[model samples]
Target chain A: MELLSNLALGFGVASSLTNLGFCLIGVLLGTLIGVLPGIGATATIAMLLPITFQLEPVSSLIMLAGIYYGAQYGGSTTAILINMPGESSSAVTAIDGYQMARQGRAGTALATAALGSFFAGSVATFLVALFAPPLTAVALKFGAAEYFSLMVMGLVMSVALAHGSVLKALAMVVLGLLLGMVGTDVYTGAPRFTMGITQFADGLNFVAVAVGVFGIAEILRNLENEHDRQVMTKNISRLFPNRDEFRQMVAPILRGTGIGSVLGILPGGGAILASFASYTVEKKLSKHPEEFGKGALAGVAGPESANNAGAQTSFIPLLTLGIPANPVMALMIGAMIIQGIVPGPNVVSEQPELFWGIIASMWIGNLMLVVLNLPLIGLWVKLLTVPYYVLFPIIMAMCSIGVYSVNSNTYDLFAVAGFGLLGYVLSKLRCEPAPLLLGFVLGPLLEENLRRAMILSRGDPTTFVTRPISATLLVLSLAILVLVFLPQIRKRRDEVFTESDA
Target chain B: MSTKPKDGTDIAAGLLFMAIAGFFAWQGLGLDMGTSTRMGPGYFPMVLSGLLFILGAVILFKAFGRPDDEPMGRIAWRGILFILPAPIFFGLTVRGLGFVPALFVTTLIASQASLRMRPLAALVLSVVVTIMSTLIFSYGLGLPFRRFGPWLPL
Candidate 1:
């Protein structure tokens, strides 16, 4: 009864003319960026972050959240049409999606992906509303020691999940932690890593680094493969799936939503992992696992549903605990901070309207994405026909303008170029950048908590292990690390890497 | 199968990182990092330098352990050329040429690196991109686009 009343209030806020307009714009832009390869939601959100400074807090959050999920919807379009995943989460969708495209079932694949995403998004939103308050109450019980332990566990899990050599991942994680330390110490007035430059006083802006590494670097990579460009060429046939297709997808969507909702709560887990894990789980559970990479509808349905669910539920950590589960969430956190709303336990109690309003808006946004994307499929397919030469320059221009717009400073341009080079090198070395990003996002929070815990404990390190919850989280992290390093797991890792080349 | 020559790309990269770490560590010697209660300006950088040193050592070790293959083709000069001139272009023209011209010139040069474009299309693209950006960013979004030169005569 309370939920319904709160939702009614939320609807009143979300359905406002201005809020609805921004939501539409966000979804439209998100889909456009998602359809275009190399431009991702993280970059798009980062670029738009500064602009939101002028908006009302709720409207800013509403639009930003819309873009986040809208990208998920748009990402699958390219995966199905051109055998390319716009974002990492959509990569798994490409496996069967592209195959379906090849077999001229492009319309069916797109429809399944869009509908599955909408369903999962709706379920995840409900789950967030149902569970977020209780979770926030639970989180409020955490002390400094517990917070530090949670960050440590998050860092360890991130390292364990990173693809490639465990040693390399660990190194990157440490490097990211070090990078996080490059600004003025919060506890003391001392400036660290400033190198006498005023700009370094604030440390490297995470948004700048994220935009540069993911967005600009992607454009550079696209330019490298000029000769191998492939536009999506499938003709659309059926827009709606038949009964058999629907029947085949039911279990996958349900299982995927469950998996995604759970994984999305973890700090390092994002849409990419959810999608990949869903596809893998679906394969394992299927009676005919051999049909997985051969244009299985389950492939499209499971990952697509999981990706959207994960994307939606990742908001849980941000809204409830004030912790961003991934880069996009981090951007959302930045937006919230800009809006002067400290996201945590008190967010619900203090500003019920904003919290509930944002939650309700997500449902409306998800519906908007489906309605917007279905008719626009043909248009997006047409967009693919634009030659890479013409397309890429415009992308690069957008990257330049977006970066410049953030500070109106040219130094950031240099920073983008520097990160671009670094991104290219990292890609060649098979080191995943996602873990580094996670480390970057978590770094300051970890340090602040560590310092606070130490002060509270009077310099005793045992506080982290003394608390039951912290101890449990630490033990889980260690177990995951050990599991990842096992010889059997190592062999599986090798197979996954080798298959990419194939 | 024929034997492949050992590739030194990893070793070079590792060595470069080590050099950078070493330089930063050296620089850290001149700064005071202070105690835990009254943290000095150098606290974080000093910590970063130490971690970077460890990362350098790990990278070097990994590079030594790997079996190398041939270098991956001439360091992709086209991409390098396309990306390198951007900062200089932005720095010089951002305040002087104003946002529109600077953006236009940068996009024009950057687009020229595209392997798919002929000279004719590239020119048309630069013009279109410049005009579209001006309209969307300046006119539509209400961002202030500075026109060329110091003072504008109305």
Candidate 2:
């Protein structure tokens, strides 16, 4: 009954005209970015975050969440219609989904993906509601030491999940933390790394860094080869799947949702991992394993379901602990801070409407994607034909406006250019940017917690190990680091990533 | 073999990391680093810088004798030249030329990053993008931005 009443309250808030409208806009815009290649949800969310500053906290967050899911749905559509997946999470979907399109079953593949995502999203939303409160209770009991160790674990997890060399990723994280340390120190008003620039005393703008690293850097990467994309616009027949196809997808969708719900709660890019994991699971379990990568319906169904579930449930960490599970969640934390709500376990008690509204909006947003995207698949296919050259200019202009509008500081725009160059160089060296971005977001918080804990314990270094929760988290981080370094696991990790890349 | 082949990309990356770490460490020395119980502003950064330096050194050391070595692909020189400067141009001129003109020029500069974009197409794209952004961000969204600045004499 308590859960039911809470659900009713959430629906009551989310179903309001203004909130619903924002949700629609968010998902639509999210899908637009998702359908397009080269631009990612992280970059689009970063560029558009400033615009949301004008709305109510709940409305803005609702819209942003919608964008996240809509982008996921849109990514799958592109994967099925064209071999190019608009997002990395949908890369596995492209394997069999594109094959289906070649066989004139693009409609079936798209429908399967949409249905699977919708089902998984619904289940994940319930799971978030059922589990978030309890998790928040645990998080609320955490002391400064526990928080510090937890963040250390999160950073370690991010480094572990990052692509390519672990050493390079660790360096990126440290570099990000150093970048975060640039502004004035909180404990003492002494300036740290501002380099005598007064404008940077408040720290480098988060928006500028995000846009530069993800958006502008992406444009540069895309420009390395200006090749034409092959769009499968024809033979998209039968919007609804047949009975046999529906039956085939049901099991994979269920298994995927289960796998995704669990993994999505983990830190560091769980949605991408969830989808890949689902594909491997489905392939192993399938009787016709040979059909995989050759238009198996489960390939389209399972990963799509797993990814959507993972994407929805990834919010658990953000909502419960105020820690970002991934980069997009980091931006969400930024949005919350800008809205003047200090993100933590207290948000559940202090801002129930904001908490529940977002949970409810996920279901609503998924429903809209299923209803609106199917009929509008033709339009999205058409968008795929737009030249990449035309798109980058528009993106650049938007990035300028978006970053400038954040603080109305021209220095932020200049920072965007600087970070963009830095991001491009890092990528050229084959370094992943995700860990760096995560480190940047968590940097100040991590330092604050470490300092607070140190002061609380009278500068005793053993406090981290003395506390049970903190000790456990540190052990976990150590275990993860060891696992990643082990020659066998390292080889397997590389194989997994390389498989997804192909 | 007299000498082991090295991964050029990893070598460059390692050196870059080391240089960055050294810079931060050198700068950190200027700030006050307090004792264990009462840490200074520079303490955490100094520790991080040291960690980074070690990581860089390890990466550099491991780069040699590795079998895998893929050539670094063609660099985006054109994109770097045009795309990187677009935001800088907008930042320098947005207050002077105002939102409309600044955004217009930014788009124009950015479009040139692609060899596929013709001059006329770029011009038309810039014009349309500027107008749409002006309408949406300036008027529709009601962001307080001057359409034209005093520099334009309009």
Candidate 3:
């Protein structure tokens, strides 16, 4: 009864003319960026963050959330149309999606991806509505120690999930943690890495790092293969899936939802991991796993569903606990902060309308994406023909303008360029930037919590181990770390990592 | 011995990272990190430097152990030139040229990195982009765009 009433209030807020318009704009831009190879939702959102400063809080969040999930939809389009994936989450979809495109079944493949994403999004939104209040109540019990442990677990899992060598990933994670220490120390009002520079006082901006690593590095990568034009021609077949195709996909969709829902609860286990795990599970379950690379509809359906589901559910941690699971969620947290809304347990009770409205808007946004994308596929395909030479310069200019508008700081422009070079080098070295981002966001939070926990317990180290929740999380993280390093797991790790190539 | 690209790249990256870590650690040593009671200023950075040094050492060790497997191609100087010179250009033009001209020129140079674009097409596209961006950012959004000098026409 309470959930229903809250949802009603949410719909009332979400259906406002202004909010709806922003949501539409967000999904539209999200899909466009998603369709463009080498750009991810994080980069797109970061680049657009400055534009949102003037928007109403609800409108900004709604739009930002729309971009996050809409990219899931748009990302699948590129994966299906071109062999390239705009985001890591869509890599699994590219396996069978590109193959289906080759086989002239691109229409059906796209339809399944769209429908599956919509269904998964609806289900996840329903789960959020049903569980958010209770979850927030539970989250309220978390102390500083518990949060530290939880962040530690998240960091470990991120390292484990990274595709390359664990050592390299760990190094990157530590590097990220170090980079995160650049700003002022929050607990003590002392500057740590500022080097007497005023700009460093605020620390490295997540938006700058995100844009540099994902957006600029991606442009560099695109430039490398500028001569190789992607072939986007595909014969449009049946838009809707046939009964046979439906039968094959239903089980995978269910499995994907299950995987995605669970993974989404874990910090750092958003769309990327959900899609990757879903694809792996589907392939492992298939009798003819070889067909996975040859355009299995299940390959497209499962991962696409999981990706959308994960994208939606990742909001749970952000709204309920005030901890962002990924960079996109971090930006959302930044938005909420800008609005002067303290996220966490109080959000649900104090701002039920904002919480539920955002949830409801997600469903509306998903429906909008499906309707908008189906007919617009033809137009999006036309976008691919836009020469990279023309497109990239525009993107770079937008990035510059956006960064400048944020604080009117020319220093940040140089920062972006510096980070761009760093990002390119990191990419060349096969180091994943996402972990670094996760570390950067979580680092301050973790340090703050660590100090708080220590102060609360009078510098007692037992605080972490004595807290049941924290202990459990620490144990779980340690177990995962151990498992990842196991000889057997190491051998199979390559298989799981290289599955992205499919 | 066949030189593997991965091995060589890893070693180079490891060395570079190690050097960076070393420099940071050295810099950190100059800071007065407060104690736990005083809440020293250098506490966080010093800890970070230590961790970075350890990680750098691990990377260096890993690089040394790996054998080069393939030959690496020559560095793409064109791509480097296109991207590497951007910061210098931005720094020079940002204040005097203002945001619009600075952004336009920087983007134009960056676009030249794309091997696919013919010089003529790149130039035309750069102009179009500059105009569109100018209109959208400067005029539509009301972001402050600098006008020309006192003697210059609008």
Candidate 4:
């Protein structure tokens, strides 16, 4: 009864004319940018983030949530039609989805992706509504020590999930932590790394850093090779799945949704892993496993559903604990902070409408994706043909305006340039930026909790171990570190990443 | 050449990390390094910098004797030259030249990052982008930005 009443309240807020309109705009814009080559959901959201800032908190956050889902759906469209996934999570989709396109089933692949995502999204939204409240209650009881250990676990998980060498990812995390420390000390008024520039006393602008590292670095990478994208737009013959195709998708979609809901709650890149895991599962379970990578309907259905489910449930951690499950969620946390909402258990109790409104909007946004996007596939396919050179300039201009409008600070724009170069260099050196971005977002919180816990314990380092929750979390982090380092596991990890890369 | 093969990318990355660590450490030394319980401004950063240095050193050490090298692919020299400066130019000129002109020039500068973009196309694109941006951000959103700043004779 309480759940139903909460749902009613959420629907009441989300379906208001203004909120619905904002949500629609967010979904449309997110898809537009995400459909373009060389931009992922993270960069699309980062570039479009400032546009949402001008709205009321509820509407802005609702819009942002819409953008996230919409971008992901657009990514699937690109994957199926062009074989070039806009994001890594959608890479698995491209394998079979593109094959399907070539086999003249592009419409079926796209339809499968849309339907699977909607089903998984609906289930995951309900799961979030079901699980988030209880989790928030538990999180409300967390002390500084537990929070500190949890963040440590989150950081370690990010490193574990990151592609390539663990050492590089760890170094990236440390580097990000340092960058996060650049602003004035929170406990004390001392400027830590301002380099005597008074304008930077508040620290590097988050929006600037995000736009530079994700958006600008991405553009530079695309510019490295000027090539035409092969669009498979001509062979889209059918919009709806036949009975046999629908039957084949049903089991995988169910399994993928289940797997994704569980994994999505884990901090540090759960959605990416969820999709990969779903692909692997579907392959192993298929009666004709050989059909995988050869236009298997299950391949397109499973990962799409898993990833959508993962993306939706990833919000649970943020909603309940104020901890982001991935980089995109980190950006959402940043948006919340900009809106003056402290991201934690307090948000649930304090801003019930904002919390529930977002939950309600997720389902609404997913519905819009299925309803509006299927009809608009031709338009997105046309957008795919737009020259890369033309798009980058528009993106750059938007990035500048977005970052500048945030604070009207000239220093922020300069920071964007500097970070863009730094990001490009780091990528060139084969370092993953996701871990770095995660660490940057969590840096201040980690430090604050560590210091507070230490002071509370009267400088006893053992207090972390003494606290049961903290001890368990730290143990999990240690176990993960050891698991990643083991020779056999490391090789297998490399193989998984390589498979996804191909 | 060295007797053993080394991962050049890792080697470069390690050195870069170490250099950054050294810089942070040097800067952090100026701030107070309070006791562990009551950390001053520099304590956490100092620890992170040291950790980074060690990680970098380990990466460097491991790079040697690797079987093969992972080539660092082509760099975006043109993009760096043009794209990186576009924002900095806007930062320097936005107030003086105002939003419309500043955004226009920024778009024009960024369009040159690609070899395929011709000068005439770039100009036309900038005009369209600037107009649309001004209309959307300045007028539609009602952001308090002057179309032309006081420095403009107009």
lDDT of 4: 0.92
State the weakest 10-residue window (summed lDDT) of model 3 chain A. Answer: A225-234
Error of 1 at A412 (Å): 2.5
For candidate 4, the TM-score is 0.99
Put down candidate 1 lDDT per residue, A353-443, tens digits, no spaces. 8998899899999999999889889898887776667776776777777667666666667767777777667656655676677777777
Candidate 2 or 1, higher TM-score: 2
Model 2 stretches with alpha carbons more than 4 Å out: B1-3
lDDT of each: 0.77, 0.93, 0.79, 0.92
lDDT per residue (tens digit) for residues A198-248 in model 4: 989998888888888988998999999999999998998788999999999
Residue pairs clashing in model 2 are none
Chain A TM-score for candidate 2 is 0.99
Where does model 3 exceed 4 Å of error? Answer: A287-290, B1-6, B30-32, B35-39, B68-76, B84-95, B144-154
lDDT by residue (tens digit), candidate 2, A349-413: 99999999999999999999999998999999999999999999999999999999998899999
Chain B TM (all candidates)? 0.79, 0.96, 0.78, 0.96
- Per-residue alpha-carbon lDDT of candidate 1 for residues B1-154, written as tens digits (9 for 90 to 100): 4354433555555565566567666766766766554435465456666776676676667665456654544345686688646655765687877876787788778877767678888788888988988888778777755745353232
Looking at model 2 chain A, which ten-residue stretch has the lowest summed lDDT? A493-502
- Misplaced by over 4 Å in model 1 are A497-502, B1-20, B30-48, B68-74, B149-154
Docking class of 3: acceptable
Residue-pair clashes per candidate, as listed? 0, 0, 5, 0
Candidate 2 docks with a DockQ of 0.89
- lDDT value, residue A203 of candidate 3: 85
lDDT of 3: 0.79
**Chain A vs native chain A, TM-score per candidate:** 0.95, 0.99, 0.96, 0.99
